[model samples]
Target: MAQQETDERVSDEFIDDTKDSAEREQAHRERGTVRPITVVGHPMLHRECRDVTAFDEALASLIDDMFASQRAAEGVGLAANQIGVDLKVFVYDCPDDDGVRHVGAVCNPVLDELPPDGRVLDDNNEGCLSVPGAYAELPRPDYAVVRGQDATGRPVTVRGTGYFARCLQHETDHLYGHLYLERLSKRERKKALTMMAENTPRYETVPNAE
Candidate 1:
């Protein structure tokens, strides 16, 4: 898969040791615009999110909030459940390996394919805002196509390859209450559990607090 174009860091308050670490940290501190990302063990993260059946002002507002929350958390994409909503909705501003931008909001999404059923990854590890401080080698298709509606109920189909594809599938999994950890082998799952057990909360509120 191609690399993802992201400036948003997954971990909360990470000190980027790049050339402008100080500048980046200062900006993040000033922004303070993040939403509470949900973590594993939250009941909502274990249940399938409901399909978005209502397209109204509330839906629009929710999408906006998710966008804000996602940017605040420095994420490439985010699902409604990630912010603690039960609706099957997600938003993204990610990129393909070639650095082309692909962005959108998808509600009530259906995947065109799934892992163990498509092209697989062996070397790449995936992270979750929900499963903070944990990284696991979870295989997913290198390409992804997701079909759903926009906030206004207009039909939308999105196709992505590389990191963008991975973003789509990851957010879709959140809609179904499936963490990347679920895709891990038993040994990896055990290690992820250990990581979660040793970590602290990433945000002030539960991811589902909304």
Candidate 2:
């Protein structure tokens, strides 16, 4: 009977802790403002992000701003460089084929420290908000092991396969001055460029009669 009472007390405490945390996070979101999304031609998107040292209030505030911007833009992932910040961090929330949700943010992510023994696959429709109206076929390892921190500075190591792995690698690549289009094959690159050119509008003038 005593053991049962102890378990009940522990469960109650856990619930209270979770509720408090959620409330605090919501309040933080309310207090923070979202940053603007940077486009492809921006120099920051092509530059590597710096490692985060001293995860203090500034880092926490940046993460909150990123989350807000991501939600506002409705993107699956966003990097710090995407918003002109040079911090090595990104957010992701992708849905599976069956509509299940997997969402999280990773700060100072390190990837592929392990051997790339996993199979590589082609995802032909990768798109980035920064690269507007652009889609390319990028080759990616179907599985990867990533290590990083969560929003609250807790260490997290995740081993993912399939689309989840693709998302992880894609965001991590953004931190390192790489875009998915850079991973396309030579033929695919030509095709993508042609497509981009065709989509671009050219100003033309009508011939005048003498």
Candidate 3:
């Protein structure tokens, strides 16, 4: 998803980085099996994913695979449905506007309501792995918070600012059956799809039926 660095700034307090986070992120990718990403036209990408109920080894494995797939696609964030699994889980390894890296997974994510006083908009170029090779300008909250469970079903709250905030919002939208394209005007959306059709994604994808 457009990892383009920007001058977009956020308060340092919102950054969620721990010393072991990077090491854990690396370990997941190493143990994961990369899976093909499902495209825009695929049914899985168009519908809401099932809320994860079991927080067991199977869920852990899926999160692992998601990290592997996101790395393969060179994405900052990924949702379970993007890998053809209809589960409300997403993994992210993104940096805030300050370039502080934040890495983790969220299951059954619910975006916290942005307060009117703090609702600053950041209009930036956004892309998706499901709609590969295309990006469009979209405005999103410059800061975001999501409440969900970790892979082990532990309650978790994640907050971010700048580009990482965009990543959180984008991945949550995926779980709710929405794509960044949905926020764009028809003309822009068409342009992005045309761009995708004209170029080839570097990563493997599951083709949608014609």
Query: Could you give candidate 2's per-residue lDDT for residues 1-210 as a string of tens digits?
Result: 011123211211111112244354455456667776765556776778887655688887887777667666666677888777888888765554445455566777777444555466746477676654557867677776666665655565555566666777888988988877678788876776566546631211111111
State in Å the error of residue 31, model 1. Answer: 14
Q: Candidate 3, residues 15-50: lDDT per residue as tens digits?
A: 355557789889999999999999998888888888
Instruction: Evaluate candidate 1 by giving its C-alpha RMSD to the native, one decimal.
Output: 10.0
lDDT: worst 10-residue window of model 2: 8-17
Clashing pairs in 3: none
Task: Write one digit per residue (lDDT tens) for candidate 1, span 136-157.
Answer: 8766678887777777876667
After superposition, which runs of candidate 1 have C-alpha atoms over 4 Å from their true positions?
Answer: 1-34, 114-122, 205-210
| Overall local distance difference test of candidate 1 | 0.72
lDDT of each: 0.72, 0.64, 0.86
Tell me how far the alpha carbon of residue 75 in candidate 1 is from the true structure, in angstroms, after superposition.
1.2
The pairs that clash in candidate 2 are: none
Show model 3 residue runs off by greater than 4 Å.
1-16
**What lDDT would candidate 2 get against the real structure?**
0.64
Steric clash count of candidate 3: 0
